[model samples]
Target: MSRRKKTSPAEDVVDLIALLPWYVGVILALAGYLLLHRIAIAPLPSALGPGALGNAMVGTMGRGLATAGQYIVPIFCLAGAAISAWRRHARRSLMDNVARSDGPDILDDMSWREFEILVGEGFRLQGYQVAENFEAGPDDGIDLTLRKNGEKYLVQCKQWRAFKVGVPVVRELYGVMAAEGAAGGFVVTSGRFTPEAEAFASGRNLRLLDGPQLHRLLKQARGSSSAKPAADIRATEQASNAAPQAAKTAAPSCPRCAQPMVRRTARKGVNAGQEFWGCSSYPRCRGTA
Candidate 1:
């Protein structure tokens, strides 16, 4: 397939507008054409003095520009609306693919841009308004911005082949979240996080999702009821805030080292489909419950 070409300044404006609802672009297109057409056709005042010559010339220039812009601006807006409609369709198609798939392996084969789109679609299915990052910049670390319950949340996606996300990645997201005053943040990977990364995220309102967790989240979201009211998101936040404490009180201790165990699902071997508690100090202590 052919790759998309680099966008020009005018195309960039169209894309930025495309990020809004598709109908909004259509409305802007209509409004822009009408306003510019009015300006283009307005009658020029008769020059009464020598100084009025410059004003007439300026008005003539304005009308000339407006004459062309009446068409040009609306074309740009309409193009944006077309792009917005295409993206909405793509997102829905992406979600449908995931819903039909059997496992998370489908995610591993996708390009980074496709992965980001999939992630954004997954969030949208969960009732969040998701905005994608189309360009790179200093704060472009955020792959997706999600809004629900009038609260902002940032997300950073790692489609890493290395299969292990570390503390520094989580730390950077936390710093950005703090700087931006986001309600929370999520670090999602098509792989697993290092123990230190998980430790740092605890109680920070930063949810970390490794491969399996993300798969389950998307699957559940697809199966769940359509986007709930804003109050549902708030209730989810309350439940998430209370989860750590509940886990602390309820988790079983490791049989070998006495450390707390984390609930984990078996991915291979005789117990491939089972859920069990495994030692948090894994690799060092191979205890299970």
Candidate 2:
């Protein structure tokens, strides 16, 4: 899958907004401290005159308050920054957790909400207009629809964890694309795709985004706010294009590991007549097909 660079304004806003509470707390604390210090020392006599002892006491108190502010301000700033950064980090971490969760039975486990976000972010990066959580029909299979440069694209989010996304899913998506008259279709999954699924997608307008592709999308989404140099974009494009067509043409190996040349046939099915490649050591290997 080609990685697209698109910044998420929402995420950036969230990050910046998350710091507000900490900033407010620090300001309030500092103001209260300064106010209390002023009120406590404002009545003190000047120059340590007749009441030299009282003057000295007040002077000491003033010095202590000053010393406290000096120590407290820096500590508060550091604490505030750390807490703000952590809150932002935690939100990202939570999203990551949702993305990486093991789908139940490798077909129905993906958190739909997370998958929608991923698709929306992917389209945004690609400069496409993406509509999230779109409901076409009960069996429509499309979670999102994207439009770019006058071409319509349909998207299906399969948040599977273990089992490879098989040809059936792709076939269903293809049917949806035809019905919708879409220019292309995308099947984005947190899990891997089976060789049959990959093969089915080949020579078709359908594109598959597996786990690694999803990771790349996440990285791009996170990095979009920062502009990438032209040189960097060129280098990435070159690297992507430089990969051997053979490598790209190869069938899905182990979804767990993208090792190609692993094919097999099911013991029984209408597809039992068909051949597929799985991880060399399956069951125990628990690898993709």
Candidate 3:
């Protein structure tokens, strides 16, 4: 069997307009100038049978459109280049910060924009190229769009500190995931999630990242984004495995420790051989179902 070749990050992303050869935009601006100059020097269409007044109107309208194009085309060219440059710089800076950060704890202190940038960096670390959306409002239903291995995933970052993220947030993301045909969806919060939210996400193409998991991912991202000459394959693998505990979501948690519970049987009592849920921590936490 043949193995599939991996695409370099540089090969994964290309904006046709933004990455246009410098000569393209220069030629467009040059065309705009020639358009305006042509109108100023050339006579109106000799074939048009319009009388003197109609011809004057036609010439004025033609010149007006050319005048507007002379400004609009160059402005659009400049804007695309500017946006592409800004995105490149932002990604570089975000990766730099990721390598230097102690943990995701800093996420709590960051503004929404910074959090969004941090999230983009996190995905980029996982071999994804992220397209960010800054509107925190309820429009578009997606905050970050990520593509990896020819699959699209949507991510929403909720920095809500005081609330246990609820089911509606996850449900809403799932709904948009269906509409957008995303391979999977993730809702990340710098806080805990409600039991209902976890229940809703289980057994589906959804992953919920609580504060602790986010912390682990950031540490993983730091290694991946480091100045090291080569990729940290081990760190990325570890982080990907820990990103979402899909199996644990279906398992019951220990009531006392609030940690995942393990199944066990009573060893020496009348209840011997009877299976029951026990705390994974054992004697340290005697919690049971």
Evaluated with TM-score, which candidate comes out highest? 1
lDDT tens digits, residues 139-211, model 2?
A: 4787778999999999888776767889998999899899889999999887889999999999999999887
Number of the predicted model whose lDDT against the real structure is largest: 1
What lDDT would candidate 2 get against the real structure? 0.66
True-structure Cα RMSD, model 2: 23.3
Tens digits of per-residue lDDT, candidate 1, 37-142, equal: 9999999996458778888889999999999999999999999999899888887777777777888787788777777787888898788999887663444468
Clashing pairs for model 1 are none
Candidate 3, 112-155: lDDT as tens digits: 66666677777877889787653224545577889999999999
What TM-score against the true fold does each predicted structure earn?
Answer: 0.72, 0.42, 0.58
Instruction: In model 3, state the lDDT of residue 15.
Output: 35
The global C-alpha lDDT for each of the candidates, from Candidate 1 onward, is 0.86, 0.66, 0.73
Candidate 3 shows a clash count of: 0
Candidate 3 lDDT (Cα, whole model)? 0.73
